[model samples]
Target: MRDLVAPALASLVCLAILIGLGVWQLERKAWKEALIDRIVARSRIDPPAPLPAFDAFDPARDEFERVRVHGRFLNDKETLVHGLAPGDTPGRALQGYYVITPLRLDDGRIVLVNRGFVPTELKEVARRAAGQVEGEATVTGMLRQSEVRAMFVPAPNPQTGEWFNRDVPGIAAAKGLATAGPSGVAPYLIEADQTPNPGGWPKGGQLRVDLPNNHLQYAFTWFGLALCLVGVFTAFALRRLRGETGNGETGENPASATATPPRP
Candidate 1:
């Protein structure tokens, strides 16, 4: 009984934890599915609509929405972020950098636009100067929310003008738009369309919406582990019970057996 106590308690605790993890994964699966659906539906909208007023911008409600804006590219203040370009072969990716340039809207507000991927050799502004459009331009693309940096993401180096994540606020602050009043800057970014640029160094339409849905697999793994633990605990308990029953039936008294042997 004493030996069984510790094992039983530990098994129960482990089982509960596994079940909790399984449930959590299931919930995450549902959320991911819904998010994918929303993104797909929004991406399919044809003839992109003009973006809403800057004052009405909502990251959560407007993310992934197809929008067009008339603005002038502030190419000098562009920030290049480390990125990868899709390769011709499946599952292959090419090293590159994304050109994030701020667009000065006609309404006197600024919005960051990810013009797209440029090869490592074309990373320098001078190398891709031909693609940089001067004067007024119309940008048609998808509106995206600011990306939160993950724990593993490295911090951006302001002096070097290199960034790891698409942190909109951080970029705006680093680019001297932080103090730009309420009507000064938009809180989101626009991923430019596939329209060809002049020099064609920085290719557009590089947005990849491939979100891996592995929650189902995770749920199955957790549930499977719980089932195996239950089987092991049941087997251990049954074997202990059988041993106790056999001992009682044989009337095996350890104290008497030893005392009699000592007297003889």
Candidate 2:
């Protein structure tokens, strides 16, 4: 009887801990759902006013916030990022690159803008020669923080104009933009608002807003597993109690059936 006390208590404590974990996952699911809702609401609201000159970009603050910016295209410093796809039909599954060009903001800050996607063949000397943006231009695009690819990938060497990832600071320096100020270029990429462009490569304005909410399914799976474990333990405990009573009734023990000493 004493030995059973130790083992039974230990088993029950372990089950309680597992049930607690399942509850925690449900709480986490609710938190994630609320965050997604906030993002969706913000996306539909009107874009904020253009940021003033010398405003430092906060990667955490302005990540998904939309804002309009007017700038001139510095196409001469453009770099093509390899291994990007377009979402349009004419721009099918063919191999293409993101045309990353620097937009000199009205306040003198240089921002790397993903102008659009272009097929690799379009970058040939002859085709690219005819695709230049002539003179001063007004580019209406979102103010996006730089996108830094954290995983293992080839780095961008802007001198060769051969890039596999979007490294904004490196690209900014390669493009010969001054970065010694407080508002130095951010280390991210911006998807320009769907604006008209010449020489069609990067099909812009295809930014799809999607956030998956499968926490309900995940919560159900965890709770169901916990319930199954609880049912198993309850049956085992009841059967053990019944076995002790049956043994005493058959004269297998000196103790009476109703007052039998608990089995170990």
Candidate 3:
């Protein structure tokens, strides 16, 4: 009984930790499912709603919501962010850049628009000058939040005009639109629709809403690990009990027998 105390206590602590981790994964699974369902329903809405006022924008509540806005593109201020073409091509991934331009709204305010992908060769604005719209034009697309960079993602290099994420504030600041007073740029960006552009350089409708839902698998894996821990603990306890029983049946105390050794 004394020998089992420390091992049993350690096993119980390990089992509790495993179970806790499993439960946390299950919670994450539920959150991911709800997020998927919400986005799916939002994406299916026909004829996107009008773009909400800048003051009313909410990333969590309005992300993926289809909306339309009438604005003029600031072609000169367009920024290119690194990206890969969507779809599984047999060869290497088609490395490209997403053209993010500022759209000046009718109210004099500005908002960033992800005009979409352009091949690496056509990354220059002059290379696709025809696609640059002049004057006021109505743009329809999905509203997206400012991208949050992962820990592994390198920071944007403003000096070299290179960007890795759709950082609205950073881009606006770089373009000198951060302090545009009442016409300050919005916090979010608009992912342009599939409308064809002149010169066909900055292609639109590149929103990738198909988020992977592997949380359930992860949850199962955690739960399975917890079960394994329980099984191992049970086996160890059983073996210990069996050994003690055998020593008692043979009329030999394990500790006394070991300590006494062979008689001279």
Candidate 4:
């Protein structure tokens, strides 16, 4: 019994850990589901609030927020990135590049506005220069976070007017603006709502808010595995215990029979 103590204790500890992991997965599932629900609710709200001032805007709370803004396109500072979708990503198709321009706000700050997708044929630097829409425009769109992925190249040459991805800091520096300081450019990007522009480039209004939360399934899998392991170990332990009992009974029976002697 004493020898079995250590092994049994170890087995119990392992079982507890497996159970704890299963519980943690369940909690994670719940959290993910709630997050999805919140996003869906925000996306479908009847009317969104007006765009906040640059001085008061906060990306973490305001990203994807639909609002109205008054600004003029700083077309000269536009940067074109390769492998972008021009609006409507119905099927995973790579059709064009994202022609992103900065909107000069009332304050000295700037907002990088993703004017929308333009086909590869229209991505030429000359074509872009010809497509500038100057003057003040009232645009209604969702505030967005910048999409910064791993760089295909070490550093982008903004001067070349070619970009691998939309890098706010690099693009800002290239635009002859100080890349630092509290009153500098906004951190995130903007996706304008389907507001039309003079140029034939795709209009904004391409908002897709899809979230996936399958924590329940994950929790079930983890718990199921833990139960299976416990069941297998229990069966093996019972089989060993039964075998020992049977051997002991047989040994006692023979001794008792001999003690009864040949007296039939």
Residue-level lDDT tens digits of model 4 in 96-213: 7777888877766677887777778887757655457778876667777656767365456666777777777677788886554446787766777767666656545555676666
Number of the top candidate by TM-score? 3
**Per-candidate clash tally:** 0, 10, 0, 5
Misplaced by over 4 Å in model 1 are 1-6, 53-56, 178-181, 244-264
Per-residue lDDT of 1-264 in model 1, one digit per residue for the tens?
Answer: 787999999999999999999999999999999998888777767877777666677766777888888989998889989988888999999898999999998878888999999988898787778988999999988998778888998988988887999988888999888543468777788999898988986788988677899999999999999999999999878878666553446335667655335565
- TM-scores of all predicted structures: 0.82, 0.75, 0.83, 0.75
Best-to-worst order by lDDT is 1, 3, 4, 2
Greater-TM-score candidate between 2 and 4: 4
Per-residue lDDT over 48-76 for candidate 2, one digit per residue giving the tens place of the 0 to 100 score: 54553335556545555555666787877
TM-score of 2: 0.75
Model 2 weakest 10-residue run by lDDT: 244-253
lDDT at position 45, candidate 2: 45
- Give the per-residue lDDT digits (tens) of candidate 3, residues 67-146: 88887888889899999876466766678999998999887889889888998988877778898888888888888988
For residue 203, what is the lDDT in candidate 3? Answer: 85
Native-vs-model 3 lDDT?
0.83
How many times do residue backbones clash in model 4?
A: 5
Please tell me which predicted candidate would have the highest lDDT against the true structure: 1
Pairs of colliding residues, candidate 2:
116-202, 117-201, 117-202, 118-201, 118-202, 146-187, 146-188, 146-189, 147-188, 147-189
Candidate 1: C-alpha RMSD after superposition: 4.3
Task: Superpose all Cα atoms of candidate 2 onto the true structure and report the RMSD in Å to 1 decimal.
Answer: 6.6
> How far out, in Å, is residue 48 in model 2?
4.2
